[model samples]
Target: MMRPIYLLLGLILSLAGLRAQNLTAPLLSGSWQSTYHNPAMVHFLPQPVTLGLPGLANDLRLENLQYKDIFVEEGGRRILDFTAWSDLVDEQNTVQDVYSFETFGLAVQRGRLGLSLYHRLRVEGEAQYSRTLVDLIALGNAPFIGQTVELAPQGEVVSFHEVGLGLSYALTDKIAVGGRVKYLVGTSGVQLAEGGSIQLRTAEESFALTLEQDVRVNTVNALEYERLDSFTLDYDPTRLSFSELTGANTGLAFDFGIAVNLDRLRLNASVVDLGASIDWTEDVSSFRFTGTETFDGLDLLEDLLRDTISLATAVDSLLLTYEPERSTAGFQSQIGASVYLGGEYDITERLTAGAMLVLEDRLGELQPAVALLGRYAVADWLQVGINLNHRTGIRTNLGLHLYASPGRVRVFASSDKFFTLLSTGNTALAGVRLGLSLALGQRAAERPGRSRSSFASLP
Candidate 1:
């Protein structure tokens, strides 16, 4: 029972770490976009509480994931939920845990074609904390076992800075075809922990061990030791410092994507990100706690150091030790699609209403989501818009878009959870959107002699 409890505690912590992984793979069917127009940068930044599109007009290029609905059909939610919890234990052993937030995207319209860009921010990951803890445990024992322990530990934080340039040509009034070339720049900070430690428990307790280090990790140095002897001793608490146990390095990486779309119904497919990798700068750290071994049993001092040294060595070994000037990192996957449903309708002479059903794929899994968009022309100079979005579970989103023009200013905000949930602070999201977009370019056709049709002509 005690063992089960320890295992349960470890499992819980491990699953908590999985929150980071869940944050990395984003789905397009969420409602926050009405306020920010993008979901790629959702990890690090707060939702765009304000829209700031009014100042200038130029192209903003940005570059930018799962499945299991089958179970939902067969009442598999409970099963999946149980499995997800069990899987959390398995995930605990993995070396990387990635999370993301603040995802936003935008597209520009030009005649028959539209160009767009998006980004995924705050993608961070590191070697499992449990592995670090384990490594420290083996280090305290030395020659009695006449063995050495080695591990290759690594970690990093990266953002998928993506740039996509798209072109669409309208084949007819209601039908069009388009494609885009996507580019990704991966910026990351990395750390690697590697080293070895040995301990002599007792002569009669002759146990020898050697653990092979993983090849992918770049460990700067290894600890070598020969045990002397053992004796009883009191524990000492003065040797721990947080600073010596950590280090970090920074760098960059790359990826590519291509997508295509059609009219009121858009079939957008692309390799979300391709050929992403991480290159780390080297930075190293080392930890040591020395004391007399207890002959009367494991000394309290020895036991504490045993625990401390294991953690210290693992952390120091895995962190950025060499500290390169910079490093690079990112993830790669195959092509996926988002089928967009246009939600535009005229409710009255001065009002228009629209909605969209968004279906998308991430890393091979499919997700279906829906959105509602409404615009009311309060006057020639002012317009008010509202958006409602829903995807999986009971999560619902609401957004408001307000525009005041001459200079054409826009302010917006949205909630990613039910209003009641928000009021109770049960969800992670809160607040409104406020932003502005200015039309800085005028077409020659809108000047005087040229008709608006000239600008509207098929591409």
Candidate 2:
């Protein structure tokens, strides 16, 4: 019951946000994996067949907050601390979360047509809040003795699996068009309704607090609540079932892209995750908290120093101060979407440089980012590259990428925020992509005078 809420509050307050970029993946035009960012890149997939084994890409875009601001070491133990959040919090804040893993994949070419099939797991998380919300909860009513605090706390966590099919056709050597269709199976989620809110007011004369709540939250097999003398909700994320993963929650999404190839330059554009929404129709619970109560009870600072309560627990209790109206209802939620416009030029037979502008819609806001990348094909079998990015949360992010096709086996790894690997406490964004695969057919060769190899060529 309360434990789930407490942990959830901790998650939002200590959020490590997500903003992802695969700056190098898309630059390998001849590799089948490059199509992940832009479906049209499929047109360049090396002849006959390319088989994918296993891969994962985890990208994060952190803004306005860091790991240091959320947790502190105390009494030889690490605990969630928000005591000084007033200086660390922003007027409005949002965090986006996503993780992707490809389980299996295959790509085949027939003349000017290319087809691909892939299965992947996708996890998404989101949370939004106002500075006043954190301040009132962490510091309590003393600072707001004569003032009113408006609180807006929103968060969501959802996970699903997708099986997809993609197709691309090269209308000409210089132009290509492609699209992908995905079938999704949702496993679990906890999400808030659009524009939910709460308010608290402390009287100037008596300092009494009046609290109001008007928020709706939805759950899809995310929590199991038990009511006894005390309240508890058993929440164990590890308890997963294969059958439920492929159960009643399902949806479809599409991705489309176009690529234009010039003698020494390439122009690309794509809209990814279009109409990407999931229908949560099973084990669904809806909660509506629209009540007003005279709030009394917890003192945050005294309770903590006395080792009696925590800020997360206090806020958890505050949320349940009023009973909520519950129902069994189903709903739909859309995944975040992004658009990319890019251009790359071949500086030399072995060197390529590129730039891209991206606009993504996350939590009802459009975030913009720009990236520059340079790659070198050292030989037909080895390739290396680097990327520099300027996005909303960070000023500059340095990246490294490497892919080697020694014989029929291909090994690859990349990152646009390699700095985060050194210290998560110092960097706001952290991400990396690792992959291993095989290409059994014609081992991607070049024309007598042209080279399309990502790695340094091996005789």
Candidate 3:
């Protein structure tokens, strides 16, 4: 029905406005959250024993679109403004939304050896669409008569739970290495298969439109399909259960990192979420549509508006013309993977500067990002830093990070795009990371050979 289609569109727009993972979290010196990006960072944390409680250590990123793209001021009031959006959007845009939560986590260190265990929940979604699709939605086929409008919008949603174990060791005073192995359980997923395309061509004379489409919706524990003794019914996504979000498939993943400390300079590198895949076998379903049809634009619109023909009936007619199919079969999905390299130089006892390069694979494309960072230790218990970033399609972004330790308790937070928080217009990307944990260990000043173990004292 039209209601479901509208709901899906609203959900996509909301999800597209957010993104995930804190690229700056790993730069914190004494926080256990740093180990998330580079496990070797455990060697630099001041805590010998750390406990991360639930609802903490959260990271989210939303990119590609902003507030100004969706709303505009009209008659002194803000209103949904698709015209404003059309003016800002490009021919092709990709939206990414990701969120992660660390439910329960712990890390312990003994001499040169460190160990960690944690459970996490992660949700990721992405959408790629052409401007023509938006134009068709907002302006309708009348304005697009005599031309072909390509509709190739595609996206996927995935949710999974992970249990991970990490090990780190100092091979030498100047070198440390670490790796994490994770078991992944997929809870729910929806993806669009390849060979899917759509085109709408409207004739100038009669205003008749020809619709051609080939779409496949694959699901894992996110839909229900029935096959009776005599007849088989199509899958119903609306009947999915909440238990699907707990997990319906299984897989494995790993992260590897290494750090080098020398004089006033330090270097670190990591490969994260590497080679992760989930196999959806239980309750899997695939629904497909492949056909071409012609309709008088005016008649179709009038019937849709007057309720002469139900939306479901019209869709059914289209599918019946093509002999739509459904299948219950297992399939595989890969996780988004990333690599990071960073270096820092100590300019003074309380001041340091660094640079980082992040290479991430998204939608079959490699996106490279660079950030220049500066941090100052205001006190033994307080550290703050700022980052200036540059990436494709994004010219500049200012980010901030803060870490405070008060009475053996550590609190850390960071954002990659802080400008979005200051403006009411949806014109920029934004993200935030926050965490709280208890630290138990000898003070940095009381430890023996503190200079040899401290990154700030490398010189």
Best by TM-score: 2
- Worst lDDT window (10 residues) for model 2? 447-456
List TM-score per model, in order.
0.41, 0.87, 0.82
**Residue 111 CA error for candidate 1 (Å)?**
5.9
Q: What is the per-residue lDDT of model 2 for residues 1-459, given as tens digits with 9 covering 90 to 100?
A: 122234346446433532224656666666656777778776555546778887877665546765566667776765656555556767887766566677788887777777888877777777777777556546666677767677757777777887889998777767888999989888877787877756677777776667666777788776554432223333322233456655888999898998776766777799888899999998888777686666444444234332234553554453344456778889887887888888778898878788888888878778887889888888877878888877786447798888787878878888777876666633224667777778766655651112442211112
lDDT per residue as tens, model 3, 258-277: 97767567778999889988
lDDT of each model, Cα atoms only?
0.31, 0.68, 0.66
Candidate 1 per-residue C-alpha lDDT over 224-268 given as tens digits, one digit per residue, 9 for 90 to 100: 122221111111111222332222322232222221222222222
Q: Arrange candidates by TM-score, descending.
A: 2, 3, 1
* Cα RMSD, each candidate: 14.4, 4.2, 5.9
- Give model 3's clash tally: 9
Supply the global lDDT for candidate 1.
Answer: 0.31
- Which runs in model 2 stand beyond 4 Å of their true positions? 1-8, 11-21, 228-242, 296-322, 424-429, 447-459
